[model samples]
Target: MLIVSTIGVFIAQGVQWRNHLQRIESRGKLIVAVRESEGIFWANGQEFIGFEKDLIAELERELDMPIQVFAVRDLDDLYGALAAGAVDMALSGTSFGTHDVIASRPYAMTRIGLVHPKTRNIADNPDLESVRTGLLDPLGHQDATKLIDNPPQASAVYDAGRISAELFTLVEMQDLDQVLVDERDFQLQQSVFPDLQFSALDLPARPISVLFNPREDGTLLTQIDEALELFDGSGLLGQMTDRYFGDALEFDYVDNLTFEKHLTARLPTYLSKFKFYADLQGLDWRLLAAQAYQESHLRANARSPTGVRGLMMITLDTAKEMGITDRLDPDQSIKAGARYITTLKNRVPADIPEPDRTWFALASYNVGAGHVEDARKITEKLGDDPDRWIDVRKHLPKLALKDYYPWTRYGYARGAEPVVYVANIRRFYNRIKKEYPQLDEAAEPERLEQLPDIDVPVFPGL
Candidate 1:
């Protein structure tokens, strides 16, 4: 009688577990708890994008269900929601060994570090007595705090707020001498607070993972594990990591801030001309403005030592071919530049696809179409996708090498210039889109023309 009762209990548990899996599939949406932080799960105002968000997208595809993300105020809220059965899973660069929640296999590792204003002179190994160090609250970071051997004499461990927000506040207010943060979060904050600089602390790497409610059956966790394994095995995970983190790791924060300042102060005077010509050529006005800023910082009278002049920095020969009588006139210069970019875009192969197609056109605008084709051929020869800009840019610099250049149609060209040129324009365009979100819909050409031109100093190598 006792053995029969034990078997009956096991059978009932099995049926309940199966029901949970069926319920999830029948619902057709996975409820995920997310916290907004850089490199984790933040929105760009228009769309949500981040490393964890991308991972969730892959999981959703694998499960054949859409993910409904619920925003939590902080990490504590994220875990609480999971515990309360409000969300099926949670992700916020969570590390292993977190209590209560079952953590998935680590997808990435990050280092804990210190960030301070670039203007400040904090020592590489400061004595704890000399400066105040800010740390995120004592709740979920006991492990991280234990690693800080020499904590500051005056420490402020925040109790309520996002970790990134707390660090930013401490630095911006100059309330703390330094603050501890993950390297990935520090890089994300650099875009907003460009003056902040980061230094890695001597600490063990934190493994980033997804967390699920402890009470849930193993089915959901199993699916996530299988999806992650496939993503890693197929090299998609590495590609995604490179796509998001590569630029941020090496970005020039100061230069980016300076360009942003120019977008507000200098771009208004010529925004109309760029929009006018961009509309005529069926291009995004911000892209044209980005290109103009890259070439001449939007100065109509700008001239390069290479004999390229005006807003677009067109050569005298090219200007004549484009039917522009006055290269220095902002209107003529912008119109000719748009036409030139459009011509280059049309010249690229039709099957290249967007973004890549646009990138190829930008490269051709910097160098020539022939040189770009050479780089594409080199990309294909090296077993990379030629249609992808990321792959092709790697081969662009090889044009300078004797072994590679001699074999290409374009005998010799400064191939690396176009790579930098395209990257700068893309960065500038993104900044403009973020800073002036209304520019596309609300900016009036006449109003922009009415704004007085702000005299911006010409920077070298622009």
Candidate 2:
């Protein structure tokens, strides 16, 4: 009788275990553990966005369930949550190893690389013995030690917590000769330190996967693996990867930090005026402020050697055309600059979309509308998408070439200036919007433009 009862209990437990997916479906939500990181999983203030977040969203859609994401502080915490059955799964750049949790097939692969300042001649096979490598604490001491067979005499080892912090240490403090970082991260950091150079290290590519509780039956794992395969087959995975990681390669760290600093130290004085004029001109106040910062660093008395003056850095003719008497006055200058940008935006083809249209206008604001049109023409002639900012930005530099400019209607132009100008404004505007989210709720301005697709421009005679 005791043996019969034991067998019956075992059968009941097996039947109950089979209801895991059904229970999740009935609950209408899946609890997930996620760590916040750029290109992985992070919250963008208003919404959760990142590569892992998108992947989870796909799973949610496939299962017809919503996800309730809980933030995990680190990888250890993510694994703990999965082991404890507190979360259905954890989405991160987790590698496969331990049998404690089942890992889905790798959704992405990334390799590590070494970055060094251009001031050093490490390009032609660097001397591992002399190079001082900086490694993030999360990278593990074993990996750091393995980076160089023979350790350097002087090395700075510290963990800044986040990738951006480590990058800031490398660029601003100049404490380390080299940094071991992920390839994607190195690409993004290159935008900040234009002089920095990178070389791929001889390390195996790391596989990124999602972790599920080992206690669950293989059914859940099977479903997730099948769904991931479907996503891959449909090319959705590729599209999502491109959308998040593709254009983030170029971010100017110094300029971004400077803009953030100015927002607090300088922008308060002109905040009301910027909003007032921006509202009148049907523009985002942050965008107008960003343009002003790009032009004059928000200096009311700023004057260029070429006679452009005031907060907006408007030329004498531009001021007159916009019907402004005193270009030095902050209010008048801002209002005039808004009007001019609106006019420039109007001249762009109507088919161009919102944010791209705004970028084209900013480019025109720097180099003039004629040169931008010439670049667009060249973009189309080259059989690229002329409406897209990414394609046009590539052709913009070709205008400086003798062969290319001679054919353009506008002749030769400092085509590179506008590209940098627009990029700077876009970064500034995004930072401002993030720092001051309340500004949007108080004033219903249009959504800010996306980051530009152009490389960081090296302006002439800066």
lDDT of 1 at 38: 50
CA displacement after TM-score superposition, residue 407 of candidate 1 (Å): 2.9
RMSD of each: 11.1, 11.2
TM-score of each: 0.79, 0.59
Q: List lDDT for all candidates, in order.
A: 0.73, 0.70
Candidate 1 — what's its lDDT? 0.73
Model 2 steric clash pairs = none
Error of 1 at 274 (Å): 3.5
Off by over 4 Å in 1: 1-16, 19-22, 38-40, 94-99, 121-141, 149-152, 159-166, 215-217, 233-235, 253-261, 279-284, 316-323, 342-355, 438-462
lDDT per residue for candidate 1 within 1-462, as digits (tens), equals 999999899998884434445556666667776666656665554466678777878888887888777655456666666676656777766444347778777787877767788777466545545666666434345556555534545454555555675667677788777776677676655666677888776678877778877776777888888888888776677666755665565477668877878887889998777878899999988889989999998789998888899999998877988899888999999999999999999999999777678889999999989999999999899988788787898899999999899999887888899988887887777567656554223321111112222211011111
Instruction: Give me the displacement of residue 398 in model 1, in angstroms.
Output: 1.7
